[model samples]
Target: MLKRLALSAALLAAVAGFARAEDVTDKLKTSAAEVLARPAADYVESRVEIKRGDATIVGTLTLPKGAEKPPVVLLLHGFTGSRDELPIEGTKEGVFSRTAHILAARGLASLRIDFTGSGESSGKWEDMTPQGEIVDALAAFDWLKTQTNIDPAKIHVLGWSLGGLVAAHVAAERPVVTATLWAPASNALYNFSHFLGSEAVEKAIASADPDAVIEIKLPWGATTKLKARFFQSLVTVDPVAAISHYSGPLLVIVGTKDTVVTPQPFAGESFLAYHDGPEGLMVLPTDHAFDAFTGPQTVDLMAAASLAFIEGK
Candidate 1:
């Protein structure tokens, strides 16, 4: 019935000269253009696992489509966080996932991993230490460099919180193209002392038992358990000092309201003093995690800055 109605309407229109054949062809052309204007997914992602001596690290790898050996970024999550990170209240995706999509949109690939003891990775959370995370990140970087989809000379590492510290150290250890840190804790021991309490960390270091666990309750009510080495490692591993060895491009992003990494942008900006390469320090008014509590727009802004820096803009 609908087809017959369209036929009868076309016949009437022809007789009345209300519409012309060229006009129908123009309408079809406009509809085709509208269809072509819509955007489609231009990247592919998969769950990948990397084997380490202690435990297996699980992560997501997102790669841009139709790029020859596209540059890739290694995304390291914040302390006690998963690869994708927590979902913003109003959004369906996590911060790292969103970052990966943003990078892919600009023809870059990304790999975001859950450090050992977090997310689906093996090992207990109590054993996590900054030194170990650096090792894990190095392994991931090495793996990325060897992957057929990546350009070995173009791999970058981006991290947040403690992971930012790890990324900085990784840059020092490897020939990374660029390093991006989000609200980084340049001074890990000083930063952790504020939350873990100096007394707790000191007690752990002073303890004679290597198997001893120092349990500290976070303000959010979650308890973090780690060995004395965790604190000791934090004290010994300084990203600001280590970053001096990394002469590649560096981008450090900080939040003014961040209490975890105190003194505003200095926790981030300190890297500039030691580096002799292209670098930038972006300071925003939002809190740690880029105010994920408020909205994801803040993260998007940071992502934009990150892409520009990585692109050498």
Candidate 2:
């Protein structure tokens, strides 16, 4: 009789667990439907100004309608990219902007900011560094915590390319609950060598003038310049080492064809370093930007994947 009672109790517990799971799924579906039923413009949008030392970082904060104290995601852009990311000329939506809107529709709020020297923010591009950007990100986090409509404990950070590196460092040092990296450049020195070539990098490192500019010509014929200090500072930061400090939930999304960051060595290294927490990796057939070779569908796929991870689904 005791054995039969124990079996019955086990069966009851299983049924209760199943019912709870179904209830959560049903709520998610309802939230998604409500988000989809409304247009992007229907969401409440606000301009945010965060003070970082002498400079003011500018950003946009978007919230889903009727969401009370919703979880928020902080979006960070890549090198030479702004808060809007590199918007595809005809459309105003870049990866960050599109992702923010989609997340908002799904009952999530997002804040995408232009790092101190990038976009409309007040600073010189030549003066921006990885450390400085990390400071700006932390400041943004502090600002977000002050918002009455945002849940401070549920803040998530997502970054692409250089921004991804920044996001990792911020997650390690801050109280971030989760972090997502999209084609994060794992090695700063390697990237400098890849873009500027070994000879140029060597010259920049040996140069006595910290302010000396190294002009690198792009494949498209335009030339961009970086200060000597930028390369010098990069040599001090190991992205994998920085990321290892964070034991929270991590999600890494990379492209198989991403010649920019390269998936082989660093991608594997990044996935293995987060040994203390839950980690996920997704590889797409797209390029570094995830939309360079594919259509707009790539953005949708990225948003869906990211939302799934953030929502714990």
lDDT of 2 by residue, 1-313 (tens): 3543453355345334321111123333344344445555446888889987789999999999888999999999888889978664345687788888888877889999999889999898887788888888999999998889999889999999889889988888888888888888777776656655656776778889989877766645788777888878888876677788888878777777777775333453454354357776666667777774345566666776777777776
- Look at candidate 1 and tell me the lDDT of residue 51: 89
Over 4 Å off in model 1, which ranges?
1-41
TM-score of each: 0.85, 0.84
lDDT, each prediction: 0.78, 0.75
Q: For each of the candidates, give the backbone clash count.
A: 0, 0
Task: Tell me how far the alpha carbon of residue 169 in candidate 1 is from the true structure, in angstroms, after superposition.
Answer: 0.9
TM-score, candidate 2, is 0.84
**lDDT tens readout by residue for model 1, 125-208:** 888888888888998998887799878889999999899989989999998889988888877766776656666666777878
Q: After superposition, how far is residue 78 of candidate 2 from its true place, in Å?
A: 0.4
Q: What's the distance in Å from true for residue 229, model 2?
A: 0.5
